[model samples]
Structure formats: C-alpha cells, structure tokens
Target: MDEKKPSRMYFIGKKEDLIQAKRTTVTLDGRDILLLYHQRTFYAMDLQCYHAGSTLETGDMEEINSKLCIVCPKHKYKITLAEGEGLYKATNPTEKVPTPRWYSKGIKQRVHKVTEVDEDIFVSVSTCPVWIESDYYQSEKGRAELKKAQESGDAEADVNADEDV
Candidate 1:
C-alpha cells in the first residue's frame, strides 16, 4: 500500500484581522483563494472564475435580487459566490484542455471548504483517489493482446476469439 502525503497548512491572518480586512487573497500551492469575512465567519473560495479564468477577488461583491453575485471583470459573467455557479449557463471551452461534450454538460463548479483549526486555517489539498482497472487490464498479456487488436483493427473479433481459443 502506498502512503499518502499530508497536506501542509499555513497560518494567514488572525480572526480579528480578518474581520477588519475587507478582502484578502492568500496563495496556497500556487492557487489563490479570496478570503471574505462576514458575520464573524471566514469564507474562502477560488480567486479565479471558472467561466473565463477572470480574477474574482477584484470584482464587486453585491446582492442582486437577494443573491450574492460576483461580477467578472473580463466578460461581466455574473457568478454566484455562495453556490459557485455561473448565472448564464454557457459552455466556454477551456484554454487548458478540451473537455468532452458529454462530461461538461450540466456540470457544476466546485468550491473547496476551509476549516478553522485552533487559530490557523487549513485547506485539504489531497488528490483524488486512484481507481484500479480490472485484473486482466493490469496484466502484461492483456496489454499485448490489446495492442495486437488495435494494430489489426479487429478488436471485437480478437476479444471474441480469445474467449473461445
């Protein structure tokens, strides 16, 4: 079994200082998260908007129709800071990687939570759990057979032939 490395936590501003600070940006693992202190509680979220990767920290935080909307500086994309969902349901192609159409449909953005421990704040930076494929796919013979089927353009026939002979 492989051992997982624990995430390192850094101490930002104190609880008292956070209340006085309107909006403070903290860098964690090369990613920036804006910290907003409201009602004696601290809320932290991604500084960049998912729509066009616009910096959301500099945007105005106002209530529109009883909903908190963070207006994007680039395209004026109104995104809800509470729910982390963009107002307009538009699929903008990411500059980093092209996502499959099926996978991107009805996808909601995720906002990570920050926990206040003692006097310091901690954010979980662990990677997703690894999923293992089937035992056949893990074997060397299965890889060779898959390669042969791909090269010959007889994947279905090879799979069926292997079961019989």
Candidate 2:
C-alpha cells in the first residue's frame, strides 16, 4: 500500500486577472507576496528581495532563454520566476555590503509554496528566522549603543568639543 502525501493549498490571485496578466501581487497575513503564471502553472514567492528588501511586485520582468526573470529594483538580483531560483545568493565578504553587515547577515533565504484553485491563486504564509552568530550579536550591541548615543545628540557634541576652538 502507498502512503498518501499531504496536500498543500494557498490562494494567490484571481484566475481571470492572471489570465490577463502574467503576474500579480497579493498580501497574506500582512506579508507581501507575488504570484507568477507561466505555462498555465503558478509560482509564488516573497515580494521582498533578499538582497535589499525591495518589493519584487514592483520589479521588472524579462524573458531570458525562454525563462521568465524577475529583477530586483534595488540591487538588480535576477531571479527566475518559473522555479523561484536565484532569489537569494550566499553572502561573501568580497561582495559589497549595501546595508550593515550585521543586519545583512540576518537576512535568511526562503522559498514559499504556490497553489492555484479555480480562478484564484495563493501562496503559503510562512517565514523562517535567521540564526545570529556571536559576531552578529556583538555587532548588534555595538550598533544599538551607537544609535542611542546619536539619538541623544551626545556623540555629536563630544566630537565638536574635541575639535580645536
């Protein structure tokens, strides 16, 4: 006897709207997501880019080598809409950091589920938390102290007081 596999379902977009357009944006549980229709199949992924948290819904779409591609507006991270690949690349020290390394280190990679029912489409509502290492924790503490000092305006005063009159 074969074991039955668990079925998953998510609501993405109206079938009519998807039929008219290749892509659509839907908000589920306060999380922004994008629905892509290709070859009569649906794919869903987080709207925010892993690189810079830019909304993929507002990003441009292109067809490369017969595959649909989504480009991040903030960093131009190219992702294939068909299989949801290239969404997140591993962090390398050689790569330029747009944001603080600590915050960037906490950016986790994710792949969401996509499903279609009748005329509507849906994506699974789930997010995975990134684990912070010792360096990340220490960096966060330093940043918090710097932020507090800046907010209090004490850091600026100390810097000016050190300058020659």
Candidate 3:
C-alpha cells in the first residue's frame, strides 16, 4: 500500500483519478484490470467481459441479489463486484410460484486485490488459474490470435482459442 511496491502489488494510478472517473482499466503485469469505485468501495476485475470479451469499463452498475454488480454493456451479464461471480436468473414460469431464481456460474470472471494509499492505488493479480481462460491476459499472442479470429469472421474461434503462454 506504500510507495515501495510489494512483490505482487503493482502501482496503478492516483486515487484522485479514480475518484473522478469512477472506473478505469489498468495494465498490471500484463493483464487489463478494471477498477471500479462504487458506494465508497473499490472493486477490481477483468477489464473485458468473461463471456465474450466486451470491454467492461463501459458497463453499468446495479445491485443484484443483494450484491453490487456490473452489467455488461454488450450482453448484460451481471458480475458481482466483491467477488467475480457470474449471476443469472432462471426463468421458470411453470412453477407453483412463477418467479426467477438467481444462480452463480462459479466465478467466470477473474478479480484481483486492490489497495489504496493516500493518493495512490495498487493492484495485485489473482493467483487463481481461472485467469488463464482469458485469450491473452498474460501475453499479446493470444490477443493477436483473438483479433485475427474476430477479423476473419470466426466467432467460435475466440471461445476455443488457447491462452497465451
């Protein structure tokens, strides 16, 4: 949390900048992390939507199932702020009491730890292997392949592409 960066922690930017913008994307150790400020708390997660790689920095915020969540602008996938849990409501209109049930996709998105120090902020990428699912969070090769696939009209390729080493 201090000016002396820790072994894992990486300096992101000034806290004042985040306070003004509300949301930002920072490249830490190679990953694009989305840092959000909502209700006086800081939330950090993958910068792109886990479902389809849409930029989450442009997403909207709302409360879902008593938890703060970011609604993906592209597909409206609601992801919890505190934890990277994916939320979805199961619609079963044929039940005795027709209602929707919320379920977790088991942390489809990756999140990191954030620390604040005076006017500065730092982030440490999660050690969980879940982040490896991202096309190229750790390198540019996966990103280039993803971009090439996207440009070639191969929508399914992105889903099957391997992570960059």
- My TM-score estimates for the predictions, one after another, are 0.51, 0.49, 0.78
Two-way lDDT contest, 1 vs 3, winner = 3
Note the clash tally of each candidate: 0, 7, 0
Model 2 TM-score relative to the real fold = 0.49
**lDDT (tens digit, per residue) of candidate 2 on 1-165:** 112433345555578788678777766654456776667766667665544344566678776556576776656666676555553334456767743221112323244576666666667644334321111212445346445756897431122223211
Model 3: residues >4 Å from true position, as ranges?
1-7, 92-94, 130-142, 149-165
Worst 10 contiguous positions by lDDT, candidate 2: 156-165
Extract clashing residue pairs from model 2.
10-122, 11-121, 11-122, 12-121, 12-122, 13-121, 15-119
TM-score of 3: 0.78
lDDT of each residue in 1-91, candidate 1, tens digit only:
1237565655776666666886788766655567776545566666655543445667776555465666766556565555555554333
- Candidate 1 collision pairs: none
C-alpha local distance difference test of each model: 0.52, 0.53, 0.74
lDDT of 3 at 90: 83
In model 2, what is the error at residue 22, expressed in angstroms? 3.3
Better of 2 and 3 by TM-score: 3
RMSD per model, one decimal: 16.2, 12.3, 5.9
Clash count in backbone of candidate 2: 7
